[model samples]
Target: MGRHRNDPRGIAQMVAIGGVIVLFITLVILGGFFLYKSLPSGSDTAAVPEGAAGTTADPQAEEMPTGSLYIRAVGESSEVVVTVPGGDVLADTTLKTDEYLSFTEERTLSVTIGRPSEVEIYVHGERQDVEGEDPGYSFAVQP
Candidate 1:
């Protein structure tokens, strides 16, 4: 019987096929990862009740068209002011430690914390870091 090996030709073809497979696998994994990350992490939330702009242990969540933002007071008492760009105060209330308020709106929201060290913000369950050491830590987020 004669050997059926095609010297370098067969080896080159096999190498090329292996390279293609690796490239395909890498792309698939990266594509899937980005797709998963792009999805909205927070589900639909309840709308913040109208005229409840005061102290509340747990304010109702807002059902905005854009996305979700979770703000929690981690101090004995924290003052939070959430407002829209056009002078509409979404929620102006004091949150007790461990209390949180959720806001989800299509428009941008500006959050001002009287005591920055006593608040925690979350987007899709990821904690956010606000840049301010003095009181009245302020930041704007679009959700």
Candidate 2:
């Protein structure tokens, strides 16, 4: 009969190496998936339109997160104040040229804008009218 070459240590070593290889492959795949997602898909975004318009509900109801609001300052910069319906200020900051502020609250939000004429407002992906305020003024948006 031929000598048998069955070593327990060798079998365990092979299994450990196989596990390491699988881990490495999984890490590589996840890295590539995240990189692809991070890249910008397009530069042609929809424009909000001119003039001070009011906040609009999502017509398609698919562009933004449900029960949340996304407010963006387009074309120019503006000072904004974000508050809940109870008048508690959540944020008061100045938006630079083309900036955005997001609110997670579902209640109505009051946004006071400075330099309203130069700044354009966009809610979610659709354009919003600043309510036709030429100077510093305020408007409301409910999500």
Candidate 3:
């Protein structure tokens, strides 16, 4: 007698094939996730703007002058000076290698770095190329 489509052996074989397919799909998805995580994500510090030293305004963060300035000492020990027009100094101190500082300032602000190449600056969530041709670098931001 010929076996029917719903026979016990046929049902078992179909279930096994379905399980194998599911396992294969799961493995493929897991492999893709690992590959994505393994790739280099790059550093946020590398987002500095190209060409001349200046502040690149971020349109998305242009609501007000209330924003934070991030300073990281990359090279040797250096001093970071922040001044606001008609206001007290925001920050004035020496930053050593791997050391960092941040301050929230409003309105017009000025920043001076003793060692241009030794420091990295970010304003209002945007990277500012404070490194200039000279040893020291300074720039003013109005917003």
What are the RMSDs of all candidates, in order? 15.7, 9.4, 11.5
Instruction: Judging by TM-score against the true structure, name the best candidate.
Output: 1
Cα lDDT of model 1 by residue, 1-143, tens digit: 65358768777888999999999999999999999998866643223446744322343433322235677766677788888898998787777666677765677778888887787777555677863566887778765
- Residue 69 of model 2: what lDDT? 52
| Residue pairs in clash, model 3 | none
Arranged by lDDT, best first = 1, 3, 2
State each candidate's clash count. 5, 5, 0
| Ranked candidates (TM-score, high to low) | 1, 3, 2
| Winner by lDDT between candidate 3 and candidate 2 | 3
Worst 10 residues of 2 by lDDT: 50-59
TM-score of 2: 0.45
TM-score of 3: 0.48
- lDDT of every predicted structure (CA atoms): 0.69, 0.61, 0.66
TM-score of each: 0.52, 0.45, 0.48
Whichever of 2 and 3 has more TM-score, that candidate is: 3
